[model samples]
Target: MRRFAPLALSAAALITTLVQAAPAVAAGSVPGGGHPAGGHRTEVLELVARQTQTTFIDHGDPGTSQGDELVLAGDLLRGPALFGRFGEVCTLTRVGPEPDSFDQQCVGTLTLPGGDLTLQGLVSVTAAGPGEVTVAITGGTGRYRTAHGVIEAVNTSETETRLTLRIIL
Candidate 1:
């Protein structure tokens, strides 16, 4: 049951609920990689986000699930890319009785100039004291088709969240 909860949280609810509204990619736009071939490159995109909305859906009763929905608009703070946005709707299922630890999948869409990139991944929040979470970019669309990277989100304030994406490939 321990492994099953986290697996279900990741597989069943995360992808379908997180990704929402995104603009279409423009034709003839260049791909996300703005680098020359034949070497590994690490690109960092800093995004400043303001929480647009949030909804707490479940309280995590013994037989029930726990989770919430988060929406935010992120502006490019530093990077070659332009503006972006994402919406996360997910539920909380714990691996154990750890108060600060839980397993959940967040579904969200990362919209960029080229087009709307579907963001799907599993987030394992080991601690909850600080609202900081790390996510793995499992897959996406358009220029990000083969995209994989690490995203770190830190809450600066009640309504502000700082996101840094160390994107590779």
Candidate 2:
């Protein structure tokens, strides 16, 4: 232990120096919280969704086979205020029985005031309808140009879906 003291001290000093040189990454501020430059932060967005339109496109065998697509569009709300809109395209990737037996590849977008956030992932389809999915934020446009994160989407009803976003730049 005696011989290891100086080496341990040097290692601790190096670690301290590295931590001091690293950038500060506190959780991001809210929308009005002034977007700081080059900060690794998380911006949270909570919105209620009202699905306005949906369509099914049959491919190949004209049934619920692979490549069948479901397209959905909706309005987004914060409380009673309608602030944005969203659209999603889901393609059947696997077909099986009900509940957890089916999966669909989904790509979606959130059209907000300043920009749009895109997402892609697999959504599990049940006999009732499309369930919930956590998707990767594939990039964005305008103010969200540098955006990349995850979105949690739940289909609360046939006409409603809820969304929560963790956006990082």
Candidate 3:
């Protein structure tokens, strides 16, 4: 499948977030149009990621199997400007006999000016051609320390993808 071509883990991993993580949002802190979610402050961000590189590691087998890994690198963009970049690693935790049936456990990060957002999810391919996936926002490194949300990615090409990030701070 074309969608499974690369970054099956790096995101599947960086669909979206950012803003000046200025100490606090002052209650008026909704950047990119966000609202309160379950009483927690929230924000939404848009981004584009163009996959620049991919590394596939085949382990213990000639073809796809458990222990296989995919490493991905790409750039993050907000509109036409460079927002930041991202990196991800996905491991084949489950492999089915069919090529399109497998799950990748992925951990990825979006390195931005304010902070780094972390994402983790189980990426599975259930269809052909360009694909789409949604993963969870686990945690972060700086201002995004309390950041949690979800990333939805749609493969625009074999090497290009669009990301939507819903961040809850």
Candidate 4:
């Protein structure tokens, strides 16, 4: 069991590295297409988030669960500001008859006070365990830019729950 701990820790570290590195590929562009009206774009200067009630457990049996809320407020280059406050309730269940295995599910809502932005999403445990989870956004409208495409500022929301993504971008 002790030997497995080192392996598990290594695997978890690798997963975290991969997730953090993926976002550096492209930091510009919207999802759908086109730039903001009049070519005015808002650049995300900094993001500060405070998450409470977030819980984590090692495995099944005697595991613990908790509920918390999060508040994230950030600044944009333009006059628009971004802020999101959401409550999260999640459970981590040890994966059946298997050691070092667990699953987690989190459902929450994100809201932006300055702009027409809102998000209703669920993040679930995946791959290795609770450390790795997939996020699915259901309904919301906001502006996001990436190298792949430009998501215009519109009332667009996920209808069919799109694809299972490992990152919450």
Candidate 5:
């Protein structure tokens, strides 16, 4: 027992020193966060989406009697991965007190590969035509936490919408 005392004390002291010197490791990460620039990472992912399904909700309100407001929801398909989805509650608030010709104050969310991008701003459709609408990206989370840019959605077909998202920082 006396002979083993020195060895045991040395081992204990070594372990204490190691523990004190070791950098703190995150639960599921190795020393530094899994990615080199976890929070400082900046990237751009471009994808084209074809509309899978779209629905327009009728409010039936006097203000929207002429269908000035279009409550829209839809899903989009991309490659073998069907990921992008969006919903818009918008109205023909610009260039119209009537229907069939105007822009809209559209509010919606676009679920991308990284995360959901909360969108809003004027959706110009009248001047661009039935197949195209350009919108502004307000904010988002996850990979797109500090995202800002323009998204141009063009209806490629009767059941398809091509979305171009140019993300900045």
Candidate 6:
């Protein structure tokens, strides 16, 4: 019992030191409050998109019409994925938005040998006054089939066009 006295006292002092060193939780501040630990605060905006019936003139020929219904899910600041038939297996990374335009990098796997392809472009928001924004993808490249095709044909053309996208945030 006599020998245990100093040991117990030392243990109590160590506990006191630890308690003093422990970080205090602020009032009304819960664990992991406001934002998640190490997680970026993201604002997700959903947009209902409609492409024009006009096909890209540079791709094949004029009057070649192809329309796509896209569901764009992304952070307003950070670009999002354009999901739909057109976005079956692709991911779009939003770089930043200019004064009236937003930039994005579209990356996806090719269907043939299935190599990776990246298309960088910008979308100009013509109107963002209301709950919706009308945007037009100015231009982008469509480079694909590089893994299986020849080097000459591997380089596909890119275009900037006038297509209206109705974004519903």
TM-score of each: 0.57, 0.72, 0.78, 0.37, 0.58, 0.17
TM-score of 5: 0.58
| The 10-residue segment with the lowest total lDDT in model 3 | 17-26
Per-residue alpha-carbon lDDT of candidate 5 for residues 37-117, written as tens digits (9 for 90 to 100) = 555333333333433333344344434233455544455444445566666666545444334345556677777677777
Over 78-115, each residue of candidate 4 has an lDDT whose tens digit, in order, gives: 11222343433333433433444434333443343432
Highest lDDT model number: 3
Give, for candidate 2, the lowest lDDT window spanning 10 residues: 7-16
lDDT of candidate 2 at residue 31, scale 0 to 100: 49
Q: Which consecutive 10 residues in model 5 have the weakest lDDT in total?
A: 7-16
TM-score for candidate 2, residues paired by index: 0.72
Show where candidate 3 strays beyond 4 Å.
1-4, 8-39, 127-130
lDDT of 2 at 80: 68
Tens digits of per-residue lDDT for model 2, 1-169:
0100110000000000011111112224454334466456678776665666666787887556778776777776776678788777777688775533466677777888999888787755454434345678889999899888777665444455556668886
Winner by TM-score between candidate 4 and candidate 2: 2
Model 3 lDDT vs. the true structure?
A: 0.67
Once fitted onto the true fold, the runs of candidate 5 whose alpha carbons sit more than 4 angstroms away are: 1-67, 95-99, 127-132
Ranking by TM-score: 3, 2, 5, 1, 4, 6
- Against the true structure, candidate 4 reaches a TM-score of 0.37
Candidate 5 Cα lDDT to native:
0.44
Q: Give the per-residue lDDT digits (tens) of candidate 6, residues 51-129.
A: 2121212122222112211122111111233332122111112212333222212222111122222222222111231
Worst 10 residues of 1 by lDDT: 8-17
How high is the lDDT of residue 135 in model 4?
Answer: 36
